[model samples]
Target chain A: MALEKQSRAAFWVTVLPPTLWIAVFFLIPLGIVWAYSFGHNEGLTGVAITGTFDNYIRAFDPLYLQIFGKSIAVAGLTTLLCLIIGFPVALAIVFANEKMRPLLLLLVMLPFWTNLLIRTYALIAVLRTEGFANWTLAWFWNQGSTLAALVGLQPFPAYQPLELLYNNFAVVVGLVYVHLPFMVLPLYAALDRLDKSLMEASLDLGAGHLRTLFSIVVPLALPGIVSGVIITFVPALGAYLTPDLLGGTDSQMIANVIERQFKRANDWPFGAALSFLLMYATFAAIALRAYLTRGQPADGHGI
Target chain B: MDQLAQRTQDAAAHKPIISFRNIVKRFGSMTAVDNVSLDIMPGEFFALLGPSGCGKTTLLRMLAGFEVPTEGSVLIDGQDMGETPPNKRPVNMVFQSYAVFPHMNVADNVAYGLKIDGLPKDEIKARVQEALDLVQLGPLAARKPDQLSGGQRQRVALARALIKRPKVLLLDEPLSALDAKLREAMRFELSQLQQKVGITFIMVTHDQDEALAIASRIAVMHKGAIAQLGTPSDLYEFPASRFVADFIGSVNMFEGTLIKDGADEAVIACPDLAPYSVHLPHSAPGSAGASVWVAIRPEKLNLHKNASEPPAVPDCPPAHNVARGEIKEISYLGDSSIFHVQLSSGQLLRVSRPNRSRYEQEHFGWGDTVWVSWAGSSPVVLLS
Candidate 1:
């Protein structure tokens, strides 16, 4: 690209800082990790450069592969749920009048103002056993039991607090809650730019509202849907905090296993290999999104 | 039979296909349409002509069931459409943007309405082709909307709406997006297409020329109410109000007072006509000594070389309804010439003459003394 602005020298002046920063802080560390993936771990915090495939072969063990499969399924489910819930929210925002539109959009993005760690903690308060979910249910059950006793009927059984936290369900819920904005922003961008007359034309042609939503609105929003699915799925696949904080022992994902390899297991080479695999999978998701949107320009999904 | 006779025959023969009764639409404090009562006959190409913000499109949308009127009921074939949605209503619209689905090809777009109704596959296929062929777009069915030209896209929209066999077809500013040359071509195409389909076509357009060229009857709307509704010739030659008269075409107006109101004729006395009084056919809706304005089209006024030479009327003097003026400016359009003459009373009047042959007529130049004249029936006096 030609930098034909106020000055040719301004190109280097503005670009050099970010390039140097990425090179020094990001790409260089990533390159070191990549180099360590092939090395053999020597004794006492030293890794010798041996260039062996032992770490990669070990990564395909049934245990690691099972974790990988479970991670994929969880990420897929999370992305699907986000899309199912986000599409309507995006549509609502797009159809809202001018005065209410920006305010509704702000509500969708308000969660990001607080840190993700705090928001995940807040969710834990809502979903945990003896938390708000169980407390509310217990209150309803008590009221029903009291009404039954007063009406000359057998009293209901004792109330039991349901287990909602520390399970696969909580992990999925947490991931969906975190990544919903990723799905909604792109959809809102696409749906807002749509020409409303197309919907009117479809209705005027004798198609009802549901038929027009499928035939006209959904197909036109395909690119944004694909973008949202890819971004949300990739991030949820590599999520560490959500699964670690909310998942049960049987629901450990590939990310938690990679973290164990780095910390408790103290296997640096294996951890590096596992993290690289996760990075490659992320790359694959982005590449698929690019292939889907080949002829169209990659639009900015600003929240 | 003549056009007006056929229209009268149609009215006497059948009930109106679509009727709008006392339609009033308001958004908050702003009234968009105020008590509009109109009936569209079967197979008539009726047009709503107005300037922008005059609520023409809003009226069309109400008929198509897109906008619900605040105080009216729309009817189709004597059936009251009180709560009918657009999909249930037997009307389709061709949008101003020509909202052909970008994701679908021309064939799919044309087949959309039939497919939604769940017709048989073979029948849908056959009908889609026929509709495309009607718009002369048979070969381009496989192309998407983006691949088509503006006129071709518009034709695709037409075919898509027509395949439904709706009782009434609505068009909103159909040709306003095309270039001038393409618009002229499509004007004939749309009128011919309407005749072929034999469906009642209600079109909303701000262009007076387009409405006059195609519509059997035109409603001129102003400020949320119709100013006049009449046949094209009636609207052109004898507009009911000064707004209608000034809007349709260019005309010269002179303030006058009605000197005499005879049975079929009235004499107008004006300061602009220092030596002559106007002998109009008494069209100003007022009595004697009432202030009025005399309107004459530029082409209706005649020019003569000398002040004493009378115009086309027999046995009439030149100065009777004629005034002497000097040619202030001359504008030469390709086929005709417009002369801006300054009368002896210092009132400016435009006189247009057709250039019948090459270099043969009495051409008036700047600062030339000329006498401008018009027959008694040429001018329509207005109250405004």
Candidate 2:
């Protein structure tokens, strides 16, 4: 009995520090946020701590509903694009030659060295009308006109650079670029652990490359794909910087609205309420993913 | 089954199904398989037996179209498989790990190949059921690979591969992952299945016993080359080289110089034993005074307790090959025992004897002086 007690004491000694740290830094802060979400804020009367559901009730307003719906749509699209682009890149890295693999992975992670804000600014430079994209477009237009003249056809009209910045397109492109590594790192880990013999067996059994990829490789890597979806989608839903800088007013997301409530509008209670709504929506998405896959094998390989 | 076996044998007597002609596979600086040329007959169970890194698997992969020979051609059914992708080849493989797709149930896995060919749903289901029944996995069609035992998973792999009905089936150490008893059972089952299907089987294995039991002909490989290719008994009883003699089973070797060479017999003189005369049915490798090894299996040696006592028989000649030794150690296997005897010349020799009649008087024990004798015709003359 005494030895058991001693073991119990030792266990506490190992577990207490992290436990206390989480309680103080995470639980207490979350508790404060929860408490703030129920409070009422009256202008010119300073912040009041009276508990009410007004803030939450206002969060479901049609105006905010549209913003939340748009947020989900954009995040879903960004996640889909990241998957289509990053999955192949991760598989390529896994299949690369031994000596070149590390260099390719390093290039994938090289974007981390630059700040997200600076990267968004750089996107601005290339995406703006007078930027490198426009220059390339004008050069192509000139080449087309020269070809037309040589062919004895009518000369082409003057080149006009398309507006490629400050829209939903730019917002999604920026989000996909920013979170591609998030999608790829997990996918690379899963693909790297896959048994190469399975691929060989599939091909030897008369499955073509594409069929083997979809039937065997992708299904086996579903865990990585799911985690990549979670990592990219959840963050892109709450994205602020990319959408704020690269988006016009029509493309504003719920997070931008939440940011305004906290800083410009000085509605801390409303901001806290909006934050909880976003958390609940993200949880719902995760729960939906889990519910859809509940019948699958728990080992992450089931259909 | 007997009819199927006869039919397979008749088919094997014809032309080869797959052939590797002067095949060489090199990975940058290292040669994995050197200039190997072999023909695999249809409906024959052939094994490439070797230790790891011997390029046996590489040869199998070349036939499966996963790899192209660096210098030569791999031909299938008289067609050169040059630049042919794996899916285009008429071959299927059972992997060492079984490689059953965990995401799919057994039926789906078995039907994967058929699905790739875009077969009708009913036909796919029927073929899957038939393949599963062939492996006796029909009841487990709904079970996933992860939920099955190692042996069951192996059967699923076999079913998946065989459903394609390819011209050849490649097995990469297919039985190595199973436990010993299961491996023995599966070995017989695999050979029987090959005969029943009448498809060529090419297996790469490191276990000589597995290759001996399951293969119709075994090719023993060593260091990226074919060292010897023959039937199992031919490899065991008449090994071509010292490597084959040692690799196939335990052999005691006596290094000696050939003193007498003749058409019927040869005599080799060594310090470990008296001038050993080996009965030869064929020509010897070198003339007299050339160094060679007299290789003898341990089980062939008879251990007698008294060295000086002659047999009671007066007509028969005395033991021609005899070595006087003291029993140093004994290993008690369930059905047999191995006696390690130290000769008067201090050479340790292993002699294996069946432990028949448990209650009988003990023949030999440790510290007992004994005479190890064999027939004059038993020793194999190894040139290298």
Candidate 3:
């Protein structure tokens, strides 16, 4: 702070650009949406600031509340899945050879290079009824039936495709696929900063690799794990495209409901209210993270 | 008295606790440790002393089951540790960084090994208390490692490793991280703790003072091999090679040719001491006309400004131990002063004198002509 005070020009040069960018691009629009949440729709394109509580009251109704609850469940499950899968991926990346570490990290981040829509569509191509997944299952089934017939046993019946798309399971699969990099990158950052001699010390003290992983690695990585959970959970909770493209009748989340209010129903005020409620939940998760990492100077990586 | 005699006899007949038999370690194209063979006796405070990359730490790591020797085998307590992992080995290490678990408190850190052994909760708790009290850290058992001072954290590491009571305890540059004053204090503490535990402690250190002060035996490593292995005095006084002599402390190397190899004594004629020779009290190595080095420590030589002082030996006249030089320069250390004496042949020799007489009327300063002499046994001959 003293250095910044002395070099005021450099301080402003560094601080002004980011402050202006956030004010113009984020805060102003968010302020407008916040105002809209307190008002009601006046016409097809207009909203009046009457300070009405009707939109929030309507959001509390059981129908929308059920959607919010289901969204929370799906997002929680997705975050858990991402943690389970990303930990080994991050550990593998950390332990890779110097020449291969960057390449493996590049592979982890490759999915973000292309557009999300394109990737979702590609997932759809593989998960549809007559898609590549069913085709591979059918091929294996035919081979098994042929082998059964050659062994003089009755062959199996006709192959049936497993339901892989347009369900809550598909929504969760898509969210885990999309948000996995967020979890892995932060975990990699945290684990990479860990003092490796602690692991050696544990091993020298007669702990096996598995015990060391659970006792030493996991506790030390709590900050990263919590940050990764929040990053994955918040985005998965507000996911709109994955459910819209792949969800069934009963699989719609709160984001899908909010999208409908703004477009097909032409109710901007209620949509803004629901969006702010989701933001509030995100703020709560972030607050919880701040509380947990209060005194720890070793922050999560990539958070 | 009889029991003490019997105990000594038993110790003499006992087998070595740790032995490295011709061990060689290669990291890709680089050989880190090369055919290093040494034996550490039971309950000995052994030290592997060397500079960085001298393979001292590598050898200790191999003993701890952290690295596998590429060529030879390691045996601890007569058991071949070929397939043993670190956890199954009978040795534990206090890491150089004192790698205490940051997430766990001191008591929990000390209890980690006991928990791994599946001891009951009560036993683990009791042992943790015992270990912490052993290090005089029982009061701070609830504090985290980050909250402790550097010396306290090192004590924590010591307790954590010692709780397991492994047959051998390995320390890798243990005091290298502490401040000089703290390091000196910890040196005695570590030595006392090792004796109290009565475990065979194998420590790797680059600091010669720490090795000399704490270790019962020191192995001076040079270029992936043990240059000399003996007690600290043997290494300091009777250095086997010029490397050991130069590495352990400051020494003056007077190059000369062996002029006479006799039965009771040998003499080396140096051009720097044209009128005097280096007389070895014992018959030394080397034939006539062969070049050899006479290494003498600075503190071993006595600097005198007057010619009336008594000689070191009567009738012998300290022959070949005396040299005539003018005091060229004086470096005034706090406790002692070093006199750089320029010989008649222009060779420089340094002699250190203690600041003993505070009330002396006169002192030897620069440009004072003096005779530097030592005992006949003060010089060590190095063949290489």
- For each candidate, what is chain B's TM-score? 0.93, 0.92, 0.93
RMSD of 1: 3.1
Model 3 TM-score is: 0.93
TM-score, per-candidate, Cα-based: 0.93, 0.92, 0.93
lDDT of each: 0.89, 0.87, 0.90
Expressed as tens digits, the lDDT of each residue in A252-286 for candidate 3 is 99999999998999998899999999999999999
**Tens digits of per-residue lDDT for model 2 on B1-384?**
465577468656778898899999998999999989888887889999998999999999888888888999999988999989999998899999988888889998899889889999999999999999999999999998878999999999999999999899999999999999999999999999998999999999999999999898899999899999877888998899999999998898988888878786666677787533343444467898999988999999888777466222222234336777899999999799999999877889999999888774966867999877777667888887
Which consecutive 10 residues in model 3 chain A have the weakest lDDT in total?
A294-303
What stretches of model 1 exceed 4 Å from their correct place?
A: A1-6, A297-303, B1-9, B270-277, B281-283, B305-320, B323-330, B340-348, B366-370
Top model by DockQ, which number?
2
Model 3 over residues B1-384: C-alpha lDDT tens digits?
Answer: 465477458667999899899989999999998898888889899999999999999999998888999999999999999959999998999999999899889899899999999999999999999999999999999998878999999999999999999999999999999999999999999989998999999999999989999998899999899999888888998899999999898898899998888887788888888787877767778887889999999999987665755346422435567888898899989788899999989989989888888765568877888888877788888899
- For this target, which candidate reaches the highest lDDT against the unseen true structure? 3
Model 3 spans with C-alpha error above 4 angstroms: A1-6, A298-303, B1-12, B271-276, B306-319, B322-328, B342-348, B360-362, B367-369
Question: Model 1 residue A302 lDDT?
Answer: 15
- The local distance difference test score of model 3 is 0.90
All models, DockQ values?
Answer: 0.52, 0.64, 0.53
lDDT of 2 at A181: 94
lDDT of 1 by residue, A1-303 (tens): 355765667978999999999999999999988888898778968888689888889989998998999999999999999999999999999999899999998999999898989998998999988789889999999999999999988988999888889999999999999999999999999888788899999999989999999999988888889988998999999989999989989888888998898789888888999999899999988899888877764552111
